[model samples]
Target: MPDNDSIDPTEVARPSSSRRDPEWLRARLDDWLPTVTGSPATITRLEIPSANGMSSETIVLDAAWEDTDHRLVVRVAPTPDSDPVFPTYDLDRQFRLIEHVASTTDVPLPTLYWSEPDPRPLGAPFFLMGRVDGVIPPDVMPYTFGSWLTEVSDDDRRTVAGTTIETLAMIHSAPVPEELLDLPGPGETPLRAHVRRLREFYAWASQGRAGSPLIERGFSWVDEHLPVESDPVLTWGDARIGNIIYQDLSPVAILDWEMAAHGPRELDVAWLIFLHRFFQDLAEMAGLPGLPEFLRRDDVADAYARSSGHEPRDLDFYITYAALIHAVVMYRIQSRAIHFGQAEEPVDTDDMILHRATLEAMLAGAYWAGVR
Candidate 1:
């Protein structure tokens, strides 16, 4: 595995268990270049970021095309035998969704060139898009580091933070194309849809094993307080700092859209705040200037409400919902690694520590929700 800080972005692939090595990926690119572009292409170097968690094998490839050097990103899904918990949606849909936003809004994002849904190409679904240059610090990778304030000047960090929030707002505000998204039937509430889908995720995780008490508690709270909310907004499921690329202390592009869907406007806000909380203590950290000094959760909710017609109330319920969703997601990832054989086992001693800490947080969150 190449060190993210030291690696030549052109020469390495993310060494996660799911993705292929640089050699294998290079060979594939060499084989496909002529078919797609009608010209020979050579992948001079391949490097993958290590942050994507069961979402996709995202990589950056530096290649030469007709004597011109270019950087391209490939988003590839895991192998089928390595069954995933949530049925993966089409990358073309994600590409078109983001592309649609770019066409309509001022949201900065990587341009999409092509998307191949059939696994016949790489033994899994893959898509190619223009690469944006930036460095994602490890501290910014997990939401828990939200408090490890950036060394960059406040103005620059705010620019990065503002770009993310603004882009999300743009995505939330953009008129969703019905044909581009596989939405639920007409008149369905997005909140209900999320709850139902999450329940299904838990069911899959607990198929042969006993359910986690933490999950049961969280699920009960979520079911009882189901928002029954409806809003015409595009919700990016895994909206977090890690997904956005920062260049010169500003976000150049918003990266992952694999879990995007149509949902209540608050869902996106709650998800963003939840993600921020995982990294920073909102009460202590000043998220983005020109915004309130309070937790970004409040700022995000207020910002979205002010921009859109709908406002987010019962913030606790939504926050709890976010925690539950992430808890379940993390647990499922561990379950996949531990039982499903989809992920490579961790040799690091801290793996178990992190898992325990995650569960503790989940359970504590569930406990608090019940108390509330």
Candidate 2:
């Protein structure tokens, strides 16, 4: 094994943007290969760039062994004292569920390699997976709307959008593993559970700071409009365009299953739409087609309905809930960044400002929509 005595867990850190390590992850691969294959392998390279403002450090690994080369991803858990977003996450369960979902449905995810559930070797729970090749669009859709419009023709963009909807449909269509997920017993609704969880999260955030009163109001709003509970689906905890890897304007692999759980179908759909705010830069905010012009809000929902055999007529309700969820997460992160000494003060700018002038617009929207 490599020299563990010299390795400092703090040294391998993630930036506020992309929290991934490109260095020394090979050491982890070296340690894991022996356990899986009964022989050590040579690691050539590892590269894990930080993702946009998301927690957790993700790295990529390239290894050579037995005269063959392999590419994979090593998702290292953040130090407990450093990233306190979610104290405990079941990465091994996540790995197994990904494999299960991949086998049962058409949802695309990275192939699995191994999962290190214990923190002994790497200092925290981490997992390795086959590296997928694709392009993740910049937060604001780096390509100009017109260029994105012209380069990938409208028809192709629609196909991609339709594919996204269909992929989600497949996920919603999959049968939930009753034994695996410790969901409440039959006839026991989960709305109260969701509410209790969110309340606890808000309480955690409000510990030493003045949290947005809007959160409590949002909770009330959700309580008032709770949908009639239906069968649960595999809710990709952080499902959004940014989490998807696209190839040739089409989604190829879905990433980030840490928060995967059995929840309302609208939760996934809401998150997918609310996270759209992250992709709107200034020009796009001013009506320029920031994303592919082919993806209308209705088109996605309609496609999902047609493919999943379920109609989502109350999309507005879900959208508002999505906005509230983003708002809560952003507020919590502001507190976390302050606690970590990364930011001098806590400020909620309605999903992190893309431009300076629209602070009021964003906040007002988040406050009313998220909390309403």
Candidate 3:
């Protein structure tokens, strides 16, 4: 594993600075918690995590309600001034989806409290849930660089990877809520609709700016090689071990519902596989071992097959699609970084994507052959 000093700061994604003031948020919560809890409440402590997401803002607070101390989390939609990552954030929809999933499925999730959709109290729509305490694979240092995940025994790491696949099985098996469908319009397959949305997002992200030729070609490739449609299921759009909160190598709370949608099982499966490879590639580029054996594509496919009793097919298409999806998001993120003056505009727009080489290799059908 690479030491902290050896890791280039610019290579990692930086967390966005807080848009709302801490005391201001505490005051608002003090005034607002009573209305929802039906009792007077006082905020004892409040903090915005340094590891807060680049998209939505996360507020962690300890409050006294009815003489009981509550450790809670607030998922707040980004204010308009913050230059949000996605075009829109539907906190209410996400809250309702979590509620439905919790009620119907055994998939572990944080205990949801209340969703404030009005955006009047907190300067944006926000939802509250019980705080889950556990380890999450660090994205800043790229977990593979050095973390509990890298320090664990191979057996323990295997348990973590296997159980995460089982969690994916559980999530896919859950009954889909109508609102979560995100169904395609007439005559469009779910996979096509998914790629269509990605195109639209890329357009929005790169509007009025120099767009990526690589991303444009990726879109074209996706259109030419769209696969035979499979029955749609609820896919955790941002599927990866990093999104999961784990204790003792077991997932306790599966978080981050912002990207939840209905799509083929392979969408989630490929994402889980590709994301780890993304980080693993970063580690190798830095001349580190980086858990090469972890989340192997074949191992992930076989594990999902055994867990779900449904074999994954057309992975070449889906995995490439996953890389395409990630490239767009990374482009948006880098765009945001440039907007914030944290990074300078590169001579080539493709330089904005941290994994440009990986995506290019995947496009050329040369990536997997070199994986082993």
Highest TM-score scorer: 3
lDDT of 3: 0.87
- TM-scores for every candidate against the unseen true structure: 0.79, 0.81, 0.96
- Quick one: how many clashes does candidate 1 have? 12
Instruction: In angstroms, give how far residue 219 of model 2 lies from its true place.
Output: 1.3
All-Cα superposition RMSD per candidate: 7.1, 8.2, 2.4
What are the per-residue Cα lDDT tens digits for candidate 1 across 186-229? 66566777777888888887688546666777788777777557
At residue 203, candidate 3 shows an lDDT of 93
Q: Looking at candidate 1, what is the lDDT of residue 40?
A: 81
Tell me the lDDT of model 1 at 286. Answer: 28
lDDT of 2 at 347: 58
Sliding window of 10 residues with minimal summed lDDT for model 1 = 1-10
- Candidates in order have lDDT scores of 0.63, 0.62, 0.87
As a TM-score, model 2 comes out at: 0.81
lDDT of 2 at 41: 83
Per-residue lDDT of 117 in model 2: 83
Better candidate number, 1 or 3, judged by lDDT = 3
Evaluate model 1: give its TM-score.
Answer: 0.79
